[model samples]
Target: MSHAGDGAEVVLRLDRISKSFGALKANDAVSLTLRRGEVVALLGENGAGKTTLMNILFGHYLADDGGVEVFGQPLPPGNPRAALAAGVGMVHQHFTLAGNLTVLENIRLGTEGLWSRGAADARAKVERLSRDFGLAVHPDAKVGRLTVGERQRVEILKALYRDARILILDEPTAVLTPQESEALFATLRKATALGLSMIFISHKLHEVMAIADRCVVLRHGRVVGEVDTHATDKGALAALMVGGELSLPRAEVRVPGAVLMRLDGVSTPNRGAGPGLKAVTLELKAGQITGLAGVSGNGQAALAEIVGGLALPVSGSIMLKGEVVTGWSPGAALAKGVARIPEDRHHQGSIADFDLTENAVLEGYRSRFSRRGWMNWRAARAFAEGIIKDYDVRCPGPETRIRLLSGGNMQKLILGRVLSAGPEVILANQPVRGLDVGAIAYVQSQLIAARDRGAAVLLISEDLDEIMGLSDVIHVMSQGRLSPAFARGTMTAAELGLWMAGQKFEAPDAA
Candidate 1:
């Protein structure tokens, strides 16, 4: 049921907002409204202009035509300070917290002088807010030392601390666990009860159905459908976002072959807040998808790095095709027919300043796209063009800097770059983290096709549903330790959750 009544005051409005970059129109005459104490979900496929429109609303971008009104006042174009002064707050998908700063410091950074007498009052208010909202993060904890879920809480607290009446959240739960997501939903309910309005942008339909009072769908940069939450279902919403019925690919029953890659009793040093792999013995079998599920910061990163050849195990041997490998590096991994899809696409997967053509050949340039001493720009461009067509990446051209593309399109480019190489093994790490439903289906289908082609695939994700749906065998990680592999249909989600929480593991022997 919606908290806001029909008679409730309208707190925010967007009227005929139109924005374009080059020939691509990011937003086209888009219009929306938010009532006090209401939650409106903005739904769309990637590149459908969801983020662009939100950016415009938050004053990160200026509309070519039309404007935004906050509580009946016209917000100045492209002035973030104006947006803030108007009590508008935005929490980005990728966090904006500084690593070296404390949570209290991050929240109070621009609001007031750090050494002022108001600092003590701010601390007391933060503690009160945290308790009232069920956002239980330590005020003095360093941001870099916090988990993904904790950092998200800080982001929300930052907005509430500024006395924001309207909050915009972009993919807020992408990295959060199911429990954390439920907690966030509860917090939103509390916020709305106190007369705050919000705009939630998400690809997860179930979440939209649960938390949003109304849903607005965008397609091809324009509003196509709007419906009350009580009137619409998840399937209908999915259809509205993509313009038709959506069919996600399923993993078919299959028998896997020999172990293609194996890690025997691997151990590594701890990094930052996350522990290293602890005597973890694992295998990626030919023609199989090995799924790893865990809470964030539970040694998943170290495991991915090991397989991607970015790190070496301090102990234990890495075997490839029945032979122990040495001198392992990214180049070595590629030479051995291993393709890595990194967790952070913007940082590890591709360079922001590089064009599509340059990123397509980043991993294979030395051996495939380049000769003894020179680069083949013509061949590289053709390869990039082929990937764009084959993977259905939406972009103007290969020469366009990859930073300009939406998250889903960027991921498609990365997938195309790796899969096109015809590798024997694949490392897909959180492959569809922030993508729309369509993109998730496409990426998963590609991995299944690769498995059918006899490639050993390792899928690491924080999403248990995706893991259970796609993997032939599953493993859970907790505190740098790996659980025994369970077949796809053998273990229930509850059973996996036990493992994920470290309740199912035996105590490690003293070293």
Candidate 2:
């Protein structure tokens, strides 16, 4: 049966969907409809059941109650094969791609497993699909060599290769630069025009306003509101998502102190994980935010590690507070008052298997929690509890494992642990990457507060808006090289984008 209500086809529908984990009801009688050739934005705060509902739709989790319908047919529960057979596909926030495999191989992996009738036909069809969808990529290129945007395109290609007609994209633009995000939106519109419906899950209110046709707001595991994007504003949508009015904190003006940290011709080895610096020179001063803007993987991670003492520079010297601290270890840097809020919170910022109490003392256990080689579990718990209260980290309790907390909460805990150390320099790498609007405001405010307290802050981020809004001086990194620092409000986002693509922006003085 085809549902052509008002002459538009309903491609997907969920009626009174419910799911629970232990005592927490993640989804409570939720309902939704995704129509053909339309893009719907699913809005919510962290842990508001958006992902839980999508997991149910994709057969990652079995719904305790209610039913899922795809293309006007009820889908069997707890079976991904059935969901895929029904033309449902999902692109997760954390990509599940085989890095060593080629793009085409990854795309056709599960769908055409074991045997193939014609290799030429498969290649030709892949090319045709790439051409039709504006998803340009080298079919034989290694997945690991591709950029974040390229990887996302490959994921979409995989879903399409599996004959998926309805797509669910989870935080699709979270890892993309401004230019890449715009290109993604354009590609999505092209797909929509080809009669494919999409569910775009995102916490970015601006993106929701820009790309969505209809807005569905989720709060506390329930459907709180639904409205046309044209009719609703970001403020109203934000209010509905968090169940309250959320205001962005205004940036404060501050007079920068003397030079505190300097990276004089710093260079690192190209170790295959991130872009290594090529004679990159930079400076950070007290009471100021020195912003480093780039497409992620373009040396931002390397720069962060070099500064945070996780990785030693192969060349050049690092000067901290007028003292030479080259080749210093992480513990050495911590001892010298350097606090790092790492980019990857799961692997670098927090220990997943450990409880909040343990993760809280990961860096400070030697100095704060341990004496005479014996660990003080009670003192660590106390510290963790304080962080939970002060940072407003929403978790079950301090005894809960770090992996069980939401991304935003984990980030909050990381910030709390590092900031509580009373550091002189702050290395905030992608500090608000996956946080909601409210959490973003909190993180930004905290960074500003740190700067106000005379910390030399090195802020590395892919978000151009954030760099422009927060930094006193901005430098663009491209191809492992650093451009000359521009004063606040000196360069536009477009100019930054060009630089991010490894293109030089020749100023009038140089011209």
Runs of candidate 1 exceeding 4 Å displacement = 99-101, 142-144, 351-358, 369-382, 395-404, 489-511
Clashing residue pairs found in predicted model 2: none
Residue-wise lDDT of candidate 1 within 285-342, one digit each (tens)?
9999999999877999999889989999999989999999999998999999999999
Model 1 superposed RMSD (Cα)? 2.9
lDDT of each: 0.91, 0.87
- List ranges where model 2 is wrong by over 4 Å: 1-6, 113-115, 374-379, 505-511
**lDDT measured at residue 301 in model 2 versus the true structure, 0 to 100:** 82
C-alpha root-mean-square deviation, candidate 2: 2.9
Best by TM-score: 2
C-alpha lDDT (0 to 100) for residue 370 of candidate 1 = 73
TM-score per candidate, chains pooled: 0.91, 0.93
| Model 2 Cα shift for residue 109 (angstroms) | 1.8
